[model samples]
Each structure stands twice: as C-alpha cells, then as structure tokens.
Target: MRKIYVIGIGAGDPDHLTLQAAKAIGRTDVFFLLDKGETKQSLVDLRERMIRGYSTPRRRIVEGRDPDRDRAPADYTGTIADWRTRRSQVIEDLIAEHLKDEETGSFLVWGDPSLYDSTIAILDEILGRGAITFEYEVIPGVSSVSALAAKHRIGLNRVGQPFQVTTGRRLAEGWPEGADDVVVMLDAQQAFTGHPDAEIYWGAYLGTEDELLASGRVADVADEILSTRAEARERHGWIMDTYLLRRHASD
Candidate 1:
C-alpha cells in the first residue's frame, strides 16, 4: 500500500513553506506539480525553487497538466462532475507510473488545501476508484487570504463579525447574502463590481518581490485594481492574487 501526502506551498514565496510541509517534502519519494500551461509556468517553477531551497531529500519531480474545464457550461454541475472524473484519472495514472514502488508520494498545492483547493477532492475521487489503497496526510501552509490581510495590516474579521470566503464567480453572480466580510479568491473577473459599496483590499503576486497591493472603497478603487492586476499579469506573465471585501456596519 502507498500513502498520499497533499502539501500546501502557500501563495508564491518559498519562505512560506511550513516546517512540517518541508519535512514531508523531504521524506516523499516523488513530488507532483501541476502545470497550467506556459502562462502559469512560474507557479511550477516556484514549487521547484522551494524544494531546492530546503535541500530536501532527493525526489523525482512529476509534471501534470491541468484539465481546463469550461466555466460556462450549460449544466454547470454536470460539467464539473465530468471534469473531476477526468482529473482523477490523470492523477491516478501519474501516481502509478511514478510511485510504483514508493511507499509515499506527494502533491504540492497552492495555499492551504482546505481552502478553495480541489486537490484533496480529486484525491478522494481517485480513492473511490479503488485503483490504489493509500493512507493520506495534509500539511498546511499560510494561505493567500492570511498573506493579503497581513500585507494590508488589516484583520480579516472584526470582533463578533462573521466572514465568508468565496470565489470570483460566486461574487460576480451575487455578493453572498448576509456575510459581513467576504474573502474572494481565484478571481479574474473583478467581482468586486458586484459589491460597489463594500470596502476592498486587494493584493497580487503576494510574498514575491513584484507584489502589488491596493485598498479603498470598492466603488472608488475597483477600476484601479483591475487595471493594476492586468498590468501586473502582462509584466510578469503570471499573477496570483486574493482580496477581501467588507460590508460597512450601520451606526
């Protein structure tokens, strides 16, 4: 039997690798990194750099292609189900080919796996297939939401105020009802437009030297954030960003 370890590498900095995550990387026989084509090659490169910086025990690096699923499917739920099935198959094949004799294999994920990451869910699908009997472990790392909050020097949640974390698509559809604070991730559509009255704090390429940060009322700074994000993406060929929006309390 083999074991699968899902480790979060944090946003974009190698230093964000947790001590426990580093230890796990060192012990794993193989490391699986997702490659989202050429545009997002930096993400894969960052993972490689982190492994080198830690001088972890020698391990093989396996590159896996991301299956870009259609986001605007007529049947969203059905499309997602199909996509996950295919994704699980690819992952299962990769693990079998690379870790046939190894007792433990690892996959490096961005941010904490528990937050908006599909790696664990995909792993579960693989397990369901009974293709491999494996124990599982998760090594957490600093999430982009935490890094964004720290970079802006603002607390994610106020005293006694509840917060919700969601994706750009959800925000664009409609601001989540009844949430005082909303943390938005995986946003390429500038979802802040939906909450024109909320205060917004945005950060891009966080933890990297080229990081960009901005904040203000959503109505006031939404355009600036979109413009800055586009420029940064063009300049760096890649960008990983996260933001927070809060509905002001009535006095």
Candidate 2:
C-alpha cells in the first residue's frame, strides 16, 4: 500500500499553510502537480515555493498536463462528469508511475478540500477501479470564502440566522430558498449583478498581493465590480473570486 495526502494550501496566502499541512509536505516523497499552464504561473510559482521551503531534499516533483474542458458547455453536468473522469485518469497515472510503495505523495489543493474541490473525488474514482491502493488523509486549510469575509469585516451569517453557499450559475438563476445570506463561488458571470436589491461583499484573487475587495448594494457597486474584474482578468489573464450576498441582515 501507498500513502497520499490531499492538503489544502489555503486561498493564495503562503502563511495559510497549517502546521499539519506543513508536516505532510515535509513527509511527502513526491509532489504531484497537474499543470494548467502559464495562465496560472503565479499559482504554480507559489506551490513550488512552498515545496522548496518545506519538503525534504530528496523530494521529487512530478508534473502532468491537466485535462482541459469546455467552460461553457451546453450540458454542464455531463461535461463536468466527463472532465472529472479524464482528470481521474491523469491522476491515476501519476500515482501509479511516481508514488512508490511505502512513500508518501501529495496534491496541494486551493482552499479546504471539502469545499467544491474535485481532487478528493478524483482520488476516490481511482481507488474504485481497484487498480491502486493507498491510504489518504485530508488536511483542511482556510478558504477564500473565509478570507473574503475577513477582509470585508463581516460574518457569514447573522446571529441565529442561516446562510447558503452556492455557485454563480445557481445564483444567476435565482436566490436560494430559505436563506437570506448567500456565499457565492465560481461566479465567472458576475452573477451578483442580478440581485440589485441585495448587499454584496466581493473579493478577488484573495490572499495574494493582487487582491481586490468591494462591497455595497448590488445596484450601486455592480458596475465597479464588473469593470474592476474585467481589468484584473486582463492584467492577470485569470481571476478567482467569491462573494457574500444578503437580501437582509440584522445589522
């Protein structure tokens, strides 16, 4: 049997690495990276920096080309299912080739693995095939949603109130039922613009030097967020953002 660590590296901040995550990095024999190419060079650099700082001198870094998929497919669910299958295949190959028996391997994920991330699922798919066997552990880290709330100086929920976490696509369709406060992620379409009456606290490229933050009633700040997001995306060639939308709050 082999060992695998699915460690959360946190939103873009280097200091977000928890003590346990650091120990896992130090223990890893191989770091498996599925490169998405130069558009994410900064992210790649940050991961390399951490590995260099914490891993043992004998540590090996293995690279695999990440499978690309349609960003705006007509059948979103089916497209994503196919994509995940391809990704599982790539990761399975990496583990089979690079991670040796009795050695530890790691996949450094952005934010907590339990939150909307697919690495855990990919690993499970590999395991389900009965081709490889490995004991795996998940180490949680801070998420961009927490970082966004912190930077905005707000709590995710009102006292004694419930909130929902969802995606931009779902938010664009309509506000969630039974929740006045919503945390939206993977919102590439500027979905906040749809809720003109709601208050929005938005953050982009959180925990990085290029971070941007803005908040106000959606009608007032929607233009600013849209334009600013466009400029940032042009400048960085990529953007990672999330927001909290509230139709009502105690404060």
TM-scores of all models?
A: 0.93, 0.98
Model 1 per-residue lDDT tens digits across residues 204-230: 888887889999998899889888888
lDDT of 2 at 251: 29
- What RMSD value applies to candidate 1? 1.8
Query: Which stretches of candidate 2 lie above 4 Å from their native place?
Result: 249-251
**Deviation in angstroms for 72 in model 1?**
3.4
| Candidate that would win on TM-score | 2
Worst 10 residues of 1 by lDDT: 50-59
Q: Which residue pairs in candidate 2 collide?
A: none
Clashing pairs in 1: none
